[model samples]
Target: MESQQEIKVIKSSGKRAKFSLTKLRSSLKRCGADDHMIDKIVNSVRDELYQGISTKEIYNRAYAMLKKEKHVYASKYKLKKAIYELGPTGFPFEKFVSTILNYSGYKVVLDQQVEGKCVTHEIDVVATKNEKQILVECKFHSEEGRNCDVKIPLYIHSRFQDILLQSTAEETKPQECWVVTNTRFTKDALQYGSCVGLYLLSWDYPINDGLKDRIDRLGLYPITVLSLLSNREKQFLLSRNVVPCRQLIGDQFYLDHLGVSQERQEKIMTEINLLANL
Candidate 1:
């Protein structure tokens, strides 16, 4: 059996202890737990320690004890504690994906299950921007010595096929499908998706910068992307003097601009011809 005394002391002091404590504190703060409540939870967990307890066990115990308190702070603390114990690698990758999609002006729907006759597929994140829908499957793995052999591509194809087959006929087909893996894709997988028009967004891409910075500042939580839009896009949509399209149909200047599109020009000319008698 491992010595309890050394383990207990290590859990309570120096760098390892401080790292865990900081992560817990950051999680609580991000989730709106007040300083006093966080301090109380930390002190309470620290006081209940015994020698020889594993760090993993300690985290589980602390989370369970906090849950019994039936307070909002407890729930917030539990969520953060779980994330810290699990490390922000594999399963928590979804948090990063959701944040990035939101930053790119999309609304995310999480963990949607699509059922087939013999199998059911769960999608990690589905997002919509404008009229375009995208299916994103996130895979997080260690940076060093990672192998994506068969599993990554299998999951991506499964989810993509499921979403494509089950969506309603009237609904927009996913304009693009992406396998957003933390590790770079195998050369074979990349070539295959490229040949078939699928997008493989690896962690090496620029999207990672927006994701990492935002998650650090905002913690592992969802954010709205509408606020992140460019100032020009916002300004163009807000200029008050821009007449409504309905009111400008008969205006020659409006017809000239509408003439840029052959289909729209025909429709506008037909409308003008019909409205002339009125």
Candidate 2:
């Protein structure tokens, strides 16, 4: 085992922390690397590990190494970047959110308008499961270090109040409001959300059940993560709101539409299948 004290790594937040070999191994394993591959990759990464290295560099090194062994796992490892590439606009991210809700057994409607007492509020996503309904506001950030602040929850809560007032006037049950972000919430935002009974889902919040966790748990990775797919190809698919990798499993028409050749399509399918099995 490499001594953690021997190396310090810079985080996305610009904080320095002791390097963790366990975390390095776990990250690869989570992306469906086999035990043998994990061991090999870790040993390779360990040799390259040094003080003052940025996490981004470390990730790139590991991803490049993984790509040599298995393109599918390499693609799976790019979850964070894949998600960021979802948009400069939050529209695609909202669709991704809806997909997650659908996978969790909710019937989802995107960009829906609900009549509030004052005016109609356009909700990013509205999901219903069983007897419960949730109105979600999706906040997406393409860059790291951007957090959803308390103002978002506060504004959302105000809108919910108007919605509740309208619902009460019509004798309808009020829908619960949730704040979902692709990144994370500020400390004050989380505190305010909890105090007001607002549900929040962010990249790493909620511990074992955060947005990233849920995606990994379902193996519902975005097709953009496929290493074989060029950025332009991925953007072409994303332009049409095609997000999930599994959606391409048997959809040759869509593959052709995205301009993927027969040869490339076969490779894409192979990777997709490998990811699904993982």
Whose lDDT is greatest here?
Answer: 2
**For residues 89-138, what per-residue lDDT tens digits would candidate 2 score against the true structure?**
88888988899899889999999889988999999998888768889999
TM-scores of all predicted structures: 0.41, 0.92
Candidate 1, residue 98: CA error in Å? 0.6
Worst 10 residues of 1 by lDDT: 221-230
Relative to the true structure, candidate 2 reaches a TM of 0.92
lDDT of 1 at 30: 47
Q: Which residue segments of model 2 deviate by more than 4 Å?
A: 1-3, 169-171
Residue-wise C-alpha lDDT for candidate 1, range 18-128, written one tens digit per residue: 225566566556445568867876666566655544555655655565545433334344432322222234544565566557755799987877554346777788799
lDDT value, residue 92 of candidate 1: 47
